[model samples]
Target: MADDFDVVVVGGGINGTGLARDLAGRGWRVLLAEREDLASHTSSASTKLVHGGLRYLETYEFSLVRKALQEREVLLRSAPHLIRPLRFVLPHAPHLRPAWMIRIGLFLYDHLARRELLPGSHGLRLAGGVYGAPLKPEFTRGFVYSDGWVDDARLVVLNALDAQARGAEVLTRCAVTQAQRGADDWQITLGNGRRLRSRALVNAAGPWAERFLRDHTQGANGRPLPARGLRLVKGSHIVVDQRFTHDHAYIFQNPDGRIIFAIPYQERFTLIGTTDVELPEHEEPPARAAIEAAEVDYLCEQASRYLARPVAPADVLWTYAGVRPLLDEGGSASSVTRDYLLEADAGSGEGGAPLLNVWGGKLTTYRKLAEDGATQLGELLGKAGQPWTAGTHLPGGDLGRHGVDMAAFTAELQARHAGRSPAVVARMAHAYGSATAGLLASPGREIAPGLFEAELQHLRDKEWACSAEDVLWRRSKLGLHYTPDERAAVAAWFDAR
Candidate 1:
């Protein structure tokens, strides 16, 4: 018989790993199973911001905005290295919304929560400002607001790392093929022959939430749960070479009454994204390989509306898409809410082991969702204790307040690793923060321009990175820097390993 655990989480995305980390920290024996690498899906393919959904205000989603705003500072503190404050410029478009309306939205965005780290939004003159140089001369005025940029995939790895550190077992590439509820416990069967018994189960399977519930969460009678209240929305992003020299990002307004963000990414790229198109009823999780031609053209057209240099398909450096598993609200995909809903068999009085289904969450609310989900399941298992995730740091997040006091941290890392390139030290500091000591303890040959052999091994051993895609794309954005030959070499190294 497989050993019993307090909870067995059946997803390795942010929500599932976050719950595992939180519950394990609370002294619960936890195990998490994922069919693939951590953050291989929707969580990694985000606009990569930790901000209150500013556009949601127009939809009158003030509560979601407030909740998201409240969690922004908390997240910035938790992963200082991966997340940092960014200023976003919203160029005025009289054809779209009026100045007064934009002001109201910015006002609500600033005051919706207790913001301590971020500066409030304010108007800006575009004539000679850093935020205006790349924009067309017609955009003479704009609004500058505070949000945060994050390495979205790294955030997931950090949570899983922290969970493992707290004694939770994280199983990547291990799918839960079936689960059977037997009285107060659940017997889970993995894709492999391994099995596990747990007192509670959490289905935090992002885009596959509904399908997972139907196929994996079985009852004593061996039947799946009824799949309901779910909608899949595909959000796509396009990356292009840097169009501007500044650090600020832009929130462009489209004539279609939708908005898109063009943010500075990885020092030499501009990341633009996100169209909300509902997936077909038959399609569950949309393809990740290519963004639709319409999506690519839409993003280029929208960004070109503001950029002095119009973008085209030929300018695209990368393109990716992910399907959001949202609550079915019978609305247009763009109009559908970003708020999350947590439901449980325990609450519905289903007489078996507790099962929590995580549905419809954005990156901003992931930590809060984890806390709430963990607290709920904890209470069901009579292990409810002090809520401890807030103000707590994720792995390598121990940089000081505002996450800006990092000069010393980088300098110190460079000093400690004498004879190492300061550039490498700086990059590692941003990637691993205070944990750079372990990663740099041994000298490593440079496998690629910025990547080292030791770094690849560390990811494989510590973070469960199994492929070139895992290390290059998700663990860090090294794929953007690696030459084709370098990428092949890295893949070969993994094969040998």
Candidate 2:
């Protein structure tokens, strides 16, 4: 039997959604299948930064850095609503990297990225500057630079939404059971006993990339590529009430050389993370366990080194962990490369089909990775469609009319929603961007009389949010602020919906 689609993409993470969007926009019939809800895996559990990996420069990954740096602007332009510029303050310690080396690295980082709207790197006298207000007196110097912050889970949904708008079929809770390359197309079997045929297949199963390939053979000639190994490295983060009153994020260096971030999250909380540890595959959500005593000690210890008031595990209101599906390079977890590898298996015969496998990537580089994957597919399919996503806007990203000035845009929103609290207005603006106006304009119906009723409805109606976990844990960080009763109420509302 022949296949059903021009392309079948397995995985609903950022890469898979991105590929589906890119292909479907080019007029190809595409189908994307995810075993769970969109971004129910590593995609939602990122460090939540659209960074250029300044640390990767130490490993001499110039090409990767350049690509990520360039994509930073592309993503910012594409989804100005879910992504925004964030300033970072990296404090200098006398015993750590020398001042000269840090300056040189910053210089390289600034030059690596094309400075269109973001400010360039500069020195900070931590004792007197805005960044030093929360720091310990011992920290007298720092480097301030720019990157972008993102709602990681929302990003995945936005890509999927864009793909669907362009006519792609996105099926969540639908798992691909098997795939075999055929003479004229690829035959794929779904867990629901539904069969699909496609001209091409993309194995973007993220952590399950190897497992998916093991089940799916390539080529009509009966040859299959060996499953590529992945190194599952778990990273965790903690959230606490606002530690400081600044908009800038902090990148704290630990005694062991690992770095952690204390970023401004939601307006009322600070986000801290993460610890790198190796865990066995097939582990059930490795991050749901409580922050280990050692990990908390390390975070508090490092945070205390730079802050005026010491932080404790008791201060942590919430925590999350994600496993980075790094390409196995046979090294310690910390030393593994954050770069991605793309492998295409094109069968030998004239009528053979093509299969693309994506292994290892970070959230920051997903857009570029998808563009490259589509280009590779274009080469195999002999169709050279002009790339359209680099400058295209993701849902709710139409910030061009607002001149991209969040402060001005937010001021306008506050005026429009005079009855809402400033906190709610700011949250909606940041979360929904230009679409906030539309969400607020909806019919008057209260799902729950809390921080936001219209906002919750918007998420449920448009974003496929089915539970309080999807809203609190993934859609936004409201779980940190809501009381137990409030949480239960929200849960009831989500269930009733």
Candidate 3:
């Protein structure tokens, strides 16, 4: 006999976890399967902003912008600890875009959706303020706008945690070897030799969506299944030592019409880049996308045009890349639609099990995508419950009742952990939020600087972290600060256990 489920979701990225969370909460017996650690790919390698794509306005993607803006407000309120309001400075470049056009665009961005949690956009004099200190003297004027920053990997993990709490079985490092569609259910075999039966299946495989359907799934008639065409675009980012002191992020417009962001990261670094290089169909998406040398030089050169101190490849402390599986719109990589499409195929007869394929989505819109995906599933599988995720929090997101005032909560945590390092306590507050109290309930040994054994155990037991890479890099980004011996020690701790 096989393990049975109402829904079986493939891929453990943001979309897969988000769908599982929503479907399971609505009373479905859901199982989410991931081939590797959660967010080991495209999901974790984002530029890490929850914003209405400001540049998308140039291509007249107003609807997408508006939808993202709406979700930005909702997501900010949902996870105050993990998501925080960020101010962005767009330095004026009259040659690239006239000031009037920019003003109009900012107006639409500000008013496109209901605004409450974040402030609106405004013009700024970048001649002598904190925001102007890092920019070249030529950039005397600019515009300031509001968006939100998120811990991308942690966000994915939190959604999975919530799904499990709602009784969904989340399996990591588990790949689906074969899936045979039955008239009313799907018979699936896993790499670990487990069998599962589900009434419905969702392919939320991100960049691998096309391949998953083509190679791993079989139709009821024993025929091959066709998948939606995808345009794979590789985006790369570089992290350098902090160049600016302020909390504000910078959005630089390049001569090629593409934009790059220089955001303050981890309190000590400036995160930049995202070159849109389209990958050929013949190329296979790798487990982790590697940043190209040309991409790094392009980012450094473009950013140097605005900053007083030029950025160089040698200055890059770390680099990452992600392949976006966008809908095939036959345009340039940067111009493709970030909006998603959910295509559901109910196998040939009445009461047939359905297969839903999720395609083309961005970080800001994952929640809405999941909601829409669930609505479609309900129409095919029968309604389980009315939408409940729109008003609910994701795990440790309950900082308060009315709004997410993260500062207030951080200060409260600091006061309680007076004996501990203020920085460590603050980091915990930001990463774990209200769960910080439970995280520090006992004084477990500090394995490395600011990383305690208790935190490692929590990650292993509750967050499904099996390796040092999951805990150090994806879960917390403490890898950047750890010494070689410290990192080895972490790996040893996992091995011993």
Candidate 4:
């Protein structure tokens, strides 16, 4: 017998989890299926900025920039622990972009949306200044602007957690192998052998969205539905030993009209990235996008142009890549719009089931995308619910008595766990927010430095962590700090369990 659901969402990335949470909160019976762990793809491999895409202003993408800027404030308020304010320094490059042009762009960026939590942008004299210390001596002028940073993977998991708490079933490591549209519902088969019937279906498979439609879905009359066009662009980032001690990030302009970011990461490393290289449409992206040697050379060379200390490929500590599924607009990969389009189909009209296909979205706008997408799907399915996520806090986001002040909360947590390492305490406080009390209540055996057995058990029991990679890379970035032996120990712990 096929289990029943109001909606069956495919993929466990940001959009899928966010949509599931939104729909589930509206009283819909939701079943979210992920072929792998949550945010194991494009979502987690981001440059980790929650900004308004400062460069988009150059292309006259005012509407897109405004929408993302508005959402930026909403996200900052929603999850202060996982998302925090970050300042970026854009060194003056008169050859690349004139100062007047950059000034106008920053002006628009500052006033595009109502700013509350963050300050406005301003010009900076980079010579002999703290912000200029890391840059080459020739860089004398720059601009500083406000944006936000996020733990991208945790954001996805938190959405899934909230969905589950609201009566949705979250199934990771479960793929929707087959889905048939019936007159009133979707009959779906999973790789795990479970069968389900859902009134509506959502295709949010990220980079694999088009492929899923082509391979796994069929029309109500068993005919094939043509998939929408998507252009796959591969973006890669590299992590290196900390280059600067300050809390600011840098945005360097490249001769190719593309930009690169060198951001402070994990308290000890500098994260640099993101080269846009388009992949052939006929070829499928790898399960894990690996950084190409050319991409690495490009990033290191671009960043080195501004930094006082030169960066070589050998300096890279770790690297990651993600394929962005963009709307197939013919142009250079960097010029394509970062906006998204939601296409909904009501099969056979009348009592026919409806399907919503999500295409082309950025990390900064996932929440708004979910809100808008849910509103549309809800109306189509006659299950519309007033949007409530705008004013709500995500799970572990409510820092009671601290409001959006994460530092205060972390200090208090450190005091409470005086016997523990301050680093571990601070990480836990920021990671779990108010939930840190429960995470440290027992503080079971210390499996590795700053990693406790209790935390591992909590991940396995509540967060659906099944492997060391899930715990190290996605759940937390402790992988960067762990030695090879320590990582193996973590793997051994999971193996033993």
Per-prediction count of colliding residue pairs? 0, 2, 0, 0
Residues 1-497, model 4: lDDT tens digits = 99999999999999999999999998899999999999999999999889899999888889999999999999999999999999999999999999999999999999999999999999999999999999999999999999999999999999999999999999999999999988888999999899999999999998899899889988876765668889899999999999999999999999999999999999999999899999986778788899999999999999999999999999999999999999887889999999999988787453368899999999999999999889988988886899989889998899999999999989988888788889898898878888888988898998999999999998999999999999999999999999999999999999998
Q: Per-residue lDDT tens digits of candidate 1, residues 398-441? A: 86542556677787777888788888788888899878878888
lDDT of 2 by residue, 1-497 (tens): 54479889999999999999999998889999998788987888788999888877877888888889988988887877688999999999868788898898889888986879789999989887778989988898899999999999989989999999999998888898878787667888887888898888899988778767765655565656467778888777877778899899999877777788999987788888888887776543342434567777677777878888888888877777777789878867876889999887566443578888999988888887888888888788779477888878898788666866777888888898888677777777777788888777663555444445677777777777878988887877777777888788889887786
Q: Which runs of model 1 end up more than 4 angstroms from their true locations?
A: 287-289, 347-350, 400-404, 415-418
Residue-wise lDDT of candidate 3 within 77-173, one digit each (tens)? 7888999999999999999999999999999999999999889999999998888999999999999999999999999999999999999999999
Full-model lDDT for every candidate? 0.87, 0.82, 0.92, 0.93
Q: By lDDT, is 1 or 2 better?
A: 1
Clashing pairs for predicted structure model 3, backbone only: none
Please give the range of 10 consecutive residues that has the lowest summed lDDT in model 1.
Answer: 399-408
Give each model a TM-score: 0.97, 0.93, 0.98, 0.99
Clashing pairs in 4: none
Clashes, model 4: 0
Query: Which structure is stronger by lDDT: 3 or 4?
Result: 4
Model 4 segments more than 4 A misplaced: 348-351
